[model samples]
Target: MRKPENESRTKTIKAMYTQIVNELRARILSGELTQGSRIATEYEIAQQYHVSRGTVRQALGELTREGLLERVQGSGTFVRSSVHTHEAETSLPAQKNIGVILSHATDELNMRLLRGIEQAARSRGYQVIFAYSEENDQLLARDIASLQMTTAGLILFPLSNRSIDSTIVRLKQVGFPVVLVDRYLADMDNDYVVSDNVGGGYRATEHLAILGHTRIGFAYSRAGDLRTTSVRDRWEGYRKALYEYQRPFDDSLILADLPTDAEPDTDLFDALIRRPDLPSAIFAVNDWVALEFIKAATRTGVRIPEDVAIVGFDDLSYDEHLSVPLTSIAQQGIAMGMHAATLLINRIEKHVLGEPKHIVLPTQLIVRQSCGARLQVLRAPDEKPS
Candidate 1:
């Protein structure tokens, strides 16, 4: 029997739905909505495409299953954000591309770094792809493996507290243009760009010491196993300050290994302050952790600058607006990103010519209200070297 006219029309409608979905997917992947943004309603989408609401829902439903849209009850629908689309014409034959493998999308510091990298990559006409590991060693290994499978060059910010993995070592041995950032890998010599973490720690502690804080405690992410180079460097800095001030290097004063792997231990800070033997001041590993410490202290009725002082690392975007106004080590994250991208691009260009080069950038301390209570004599201190 011959197909009916209605059946043919239904087939055409289904094809049209596929077309609409593809068009919308293209737009989303091209960063039209980008991150954590909602799209128009199904009714609106139907009206825009001149299709039935059912058809629109079907298309969106499929996209949602594919992790392209997030549907919320009563709150409507949103675009899912976990892919990068490039405008590079495939006709050019193997265009240069860079891959960045980071831990996760957690804070503004990493976002600012991404902005710098994007600026540099777009300027040089290179496509950039990003991958995030869920802070798991196995997951990080998988990401690295995937990067090795595709991509020309890689920029990695490893996630580990103590040591480098053998998988990373194998990847480096395969002559991968892997430039590390933020964290360093032991037993492997590769191009990397990192901030002066140790110096930042030293300066923060030193600032606290100068304020007449004889008993200053250091708080960081990891506790006993300070294997990560950044952690060790910062802890060393803390010790250096204590030694210089002739204070006993009490291990109890160093709060390491936060409650979770992702962030610092805010609960510990609260408990520490509640204890009768409280340090005069505290130096936090990062700005986020510092903020948490400040909040905890405030909640416990600890007066800032009077009862307890605080200094943090990574002068984050919102540090100035923070309640206590963070005093932190200002790492040029954007500059670091730009510089790392430039280095990777140079490697890609020079692959046809020669070898790759490693780059290093310095870090600086930004004095603010949190640690300025003791610097009243100087009024405005000179900007210290990074």
Candidate 2:
């Protein structure tokens, strides 16, 4: 029997093989590599990708099975004559697969949701494929078109939250089995699974209000047009909480589009710090934004919760490890994924019949040191670091 070390190695090799297959398939679809044109030999491909000959062979074999590649035994692997053009990809019958399109594949929340989708999909005897949209609308549309050729159904964590996208509308027109995850277009009635962002926002803000924070800032984005249903819902909840607590909503404290993950934008945050009557706490859009606020505050010697309490949505995995563990709203990501996949599979297999279903899961407020509930109060920080 193979040991755990061998199992790890096998998974890595399999991942490498799948990557190679995707890259090669993309080349064929884009006409970069033409049909009936010979590709590099196993040894050459192995060298180019820095993978082993066995891995190259495995990738070629899978493509061959998919009718995208042909092996002449002696001559090298060649693009199949039938596999031409992206539009013509559906020349072959669709596979028993479910495709998931999301913003990022490596994100913790996305990964967790994918685990649930994969669990539900495989248990129903369906294979799952994934494509990343990187939050681009054009690329997301292109991905949906390409994936539909091979997959039985698709689940989208779409790029836009503002308006009804034409691509998704077309899918509905054709009656294609597709489910929207995390966010949905409010105009259309479609199958969707999402967390209760409004409640999550309300809970986070109420927590801060309970801690005696009357001046709470909503850290939204300057890119007002891109705010999705999830973001808008959260903001609505923030407003609701303020009304409930009888706190005045200050428009001046609205921090918009200060990105720190890609490139640090210190001007907005720094300007907020200079305000004479600054907010005592901040409710960030998400954990990424919360972390960015904490980072900016830490840099300027503005303490967390003490100086200004910070709370975020989408309780990410590494929140606890921060210098000040962030208090965040935890969504049922796994359950969301499972529900989405199950719903899509039901449509695919004709197991369920009814109007389109929209499932909204609940959220939990995870309190930690960042909220000043468990740690020493803010004023005790006594001195600022120079």
TM-score leader = 2
Each model's total of backbone clashes: 7, 5
Against the true structure, what is every candidate's RMSD? 14.5, 9.0
Pairs that collide, model 1: 161-228, 162-227, 162-228, 222-256, 222-257, 223-256, 223-257
Output the lDDT of residue 255, model 2.
71
lDDT of 2 by residue, 64-165 (tens): 876678888777788888553433333334657788887764566776677688779879877666767777888888889888878888999877546577
At residue 247, what lDDT does model 2 achieve? 75
C-alpha lDDT (0 to 100) for residue 179 of candidate 2: 95
Error of 1 at 200 (Å): 1.2
How much does candidate 2 score in TM-score? 0.73
TM-score of each: 0.71, 0.73
